[model samples]
Target: MAGRGLHHVTLISSDAERSCRFYACFLGMRLVKRTVSHEDPGTFHLCFGDEAGRPGTLFTLFPWQRVPRGRRGACEAWQTSFRIPSGSLDWWSRRLSEADVPHRLDQTAFGENCLTFEDPDGAMLALVEANPFTQPAVWNSSEVPAAHALQGLHDLVLKVREADPLSELFREVLGFTEIGRNGKLVRLATHDGAGGTITLDETGRLARGQLGAGSIHHVAIRARDAADQDALVQALHDRYGIVTTEPKDRIYYRSVNFRSTCGLLLEIATDGPGVDVDESFEALGMGLKLPSSLEERRGELELLLPSLPIPTCNRHVFEEIT
Candidate 1:
């Protein structure tokens, strides 16, 4: 029942257009899928990732135009971090400045350099120079250069009232090993590196988090296949008395979700029949895609969902960098 790594982190956004600008244009992630939320057909579900929308690289969003801003506190996935090349922080700083995206250079307690920033909806994000550099999948089309493009998800930070119980579950059921600790921060990692790291920050005094725009919906861990996913679900039930829902088909992947001891939502997601299942590589994210159930009402749903703007590189900034 060893987990692969992270499948994706889902977040709520107030506006789809603003999210696209921040994530796609400025951050340089490609919008690999554009679809409607299965739960709420009126809302847009936008998925951003590497060129292929790989499991560890995905950041999916549900945009609710009128949702209120959320408050960040305990029992929340506080920040999402992406992996960047070791020497690319300076280039990223300059690019962030040029794009008017406010960010600051900071270091973790473990001394890894990171650039922290926020999206239009105020979702916290960071780029860390942790993992070894790898060529970006969207190199040719991204606003960022190949050398500096974001590689994939680095890790996630979870702010919890207590870390011990959750940490134990991760070790016993999720196959994570405690790698390091620094005061309130306890770091854990799976065998895989891409989106395998997690830092639990114990903040017992913080208030409970509220769900709304700008808050993380859930963090999904990778399940290699149906059998792997079933094994995990069984282990959780047998060990911790945790009950998970039956696997729900998400078009690209299947998922089973449950709440952690700290009240943070977590999901186990299978990795097959990926984003390329329905669209060709070249035409990914170019059109609105609907499931078979919704195909008949595509016109009505399209009218309900707001039109999204296509993301493109700013020629002025691109020229300056070139």
Candidate 2:
């Protein structure tokens, strides 16, 4: 079935608090959740996004204290794109410059102009004009100075050794059609355009990507609910022999993940039990809104976590708490 759009994109991090500070201050996102990793404790999982903490806007961090740094040449994620106002390219450039942020300026085959940069932890990311090709975003009630904040994740590029199996899944299974194909890259996309496009690349049998500050954990696609997710999971198994787990509640939403043949990771997530379900959108990240069990440990958690609000340039000093 033609389904819901892009959900959140998850990634791994070496330092959760430090990464959180970078994203929150620099990107103007709200810290929606901070908890121990479901798979491992001592390790932490954090999420950042607009006040509402909607799907497309959600970005998660998995702080694996032992992961090593990775190189950027190939075999890893190419870049993550963000949406900005139509004429905000100049403003963004100035903001990045003022922040002393290191980035690159170039034009994509789609003809959109872009500026790439690395986060404090070396995660590759970029800012692109949400111009003549994109629609205006609905601002979040809890997002500060809302209008200028990012609408959501624009798109992401995955540089794999091969694109055949992965590209086939995007179209034949997920319903994303190949909208643009060019040298080394094939782009599959959804309508919202916020989760913009998924670009699959054939950059040779590149080295396997390392999970560090800048590496993606998995890209999550939106699934309606338990019933819907079950059906979709079955579809993947039936059609492609790709198996997925039963939906597991992630506190905020339910999800299941599977690795693609090309080595990319993908997850299907439900939209409900939204950010507001746990905390009001307008009041998110304002306090240490922790689970009752974690409440008693807040003092220790806070102390263990690094300081929030890392430095950044003019526009917004986005910070992230990994």
Candidates in order, TM-scores: namely 0.94, 0.85
Error of 2 at 256 (Å): 0.7
The lDDT for every candidate, in the order shown, is 0.85, 0.69
For candidate 2, give the lDDT of residue 74. Answer: 48
lDDT of 2 by residue, 1-322 (tens): 7656578887776665556656776666767766655554445667777556777778888777546765554444667888766666677677688777777787776777778887766777877776533443444433234555677778788887788777787777677888888887888886655674677778885677556656777788887787777877888898888878767777778989886666567888988878676667666655544555566777787776545443233332333333
Q: List ranges where model 1 is wrong by over 4 Å.
A: 133-139, 313-322
Deviation in angstroms for 56 in model 1?
0.6
lDDT of 1 by residue, 179-227 (tens): 9999999999885456888899999889988888889999999989889
